[model samples]
Target: MSDILFTSSATAKNGRDGHVKSSDGMIDLDLVNPAENKEGKGSNPEQLFAAGYAACFDGALNLVASKKDKQIDSTTTAEVSFMKDKEDGGFKIGVTMNVEVQGVSPEDAEELVEAAHQFCPYSKATRGNIDVKLVPQAIE
Candidate 1:
């Protein structure tokens, strides 16, 4: 058996399964649910995807800004969208970034979006691997 200490656990019931505590126990997450969960009781994979995409985008953009010698406010965020492709027969996940950074130009923002697409963990995970659409838009 592994020596790691268990922090939390989740069971599938009422549409959601289990919960786990992060390092800072203030925020906890349910590890399982249906593909697209109905609101209120349980959370589905869409919410998880959105959460992961948002975090990944923010982190990736931070790295991009650091590489470009630019500073970004940690408050900046990205909105992720997951929509069904009726004709294509799959799902699409679109990411739009809303950033408020000083001294950053439109071009820089564009580059940062591209860089984030390359670096964001969720972006890579969804693109090609999954039948999902990924769109990252940069906004001020």
Candidate 2:
């Protein structure tokens, strides 16, 4: 069982080529079908999911850093790919989270990223259900 901290709702009309709006009126945007336009004229489900995962993973990293009494001055980029499962006859997603941790040693950063992956809700949710790769990037 889980206790809810907050809840959000959004509705999409006309499928992938339509419009989506959040209940709070914060997110209102038009969606373009990726099939029609590879570089969609507007937002798409894959983009939205990538954004959410990026934010959530960042937060999870921060939380883990705080717990460990460490500070991370970095950013995470989530690259999500949506592809059709030819054999399964449906769509599936692949995710790669590139974590660039600043103010920490490369080894430490790698450790923290692994820990964050373990703690991130999105990671846990997608584990075994999807293919996710966590890549730790060194600060240049």
Candidate 3:
């Protein structure tokens, strides 16, 4: 696009009951449907999306805090749900990002999180396409 910073590629085969391997070979894993994965033998698309979003959001939060001259230690947990789309009779995804920030007041933590949502690339990409809820907490 506009001076690409990086690109990542992964290939998935056999749909939900298959294997996924990245171009760099760092993320080779088995794929399983969440509902059918009773034994939890493999990873699902939702799990991978959650992991990427959480890491990106947390980095965005720290960057925002640094710009405001505030130091914060934070962890972001992204809970992704796969559900039916009543509007289109298809499936959809939703995300809830629970962020805990230390070394800041609760109010400040909330503000930082809001700012991060605006800055995070993943949040921007999914802004109008999906539903995302942000919950921020301060660890005093």
Best by TM-score: 3
lDDT of 1: 0.60
Q: Each prediction's TM-score against the native?
A: 0.57, 0.93, 0.97
Winner on TM-score between 2 and 3 is 3
User: Using lDDT as the measure, what is the rank order of every candidate, best first?
Assistant: 3, 2, 1
Local distance difference test, each candidate: 0.60, 0.89, 0.96
lDDT string for model 1 (1-140, tens) is: 55877544433434346665546555456655454444536445456656666776778878888988887654345565666777789876555556544446667766776777788767777667544333434335
Error of model 2, residue 44, in angstroms: 0.3
Give candidate 3 regions above 4 Å deviation: none
Clashes of each: 3, 0, 0
* Candidates by TM-score, descending order: 3, 2, 1
Model 3: pairs clashing at backbone N, Cα or C within 3 Å: none
Runs of candidate 2 exceeding 4 Å displacement:
none
- The RMSD (Cα, Å) of candidate 3 is 0.8
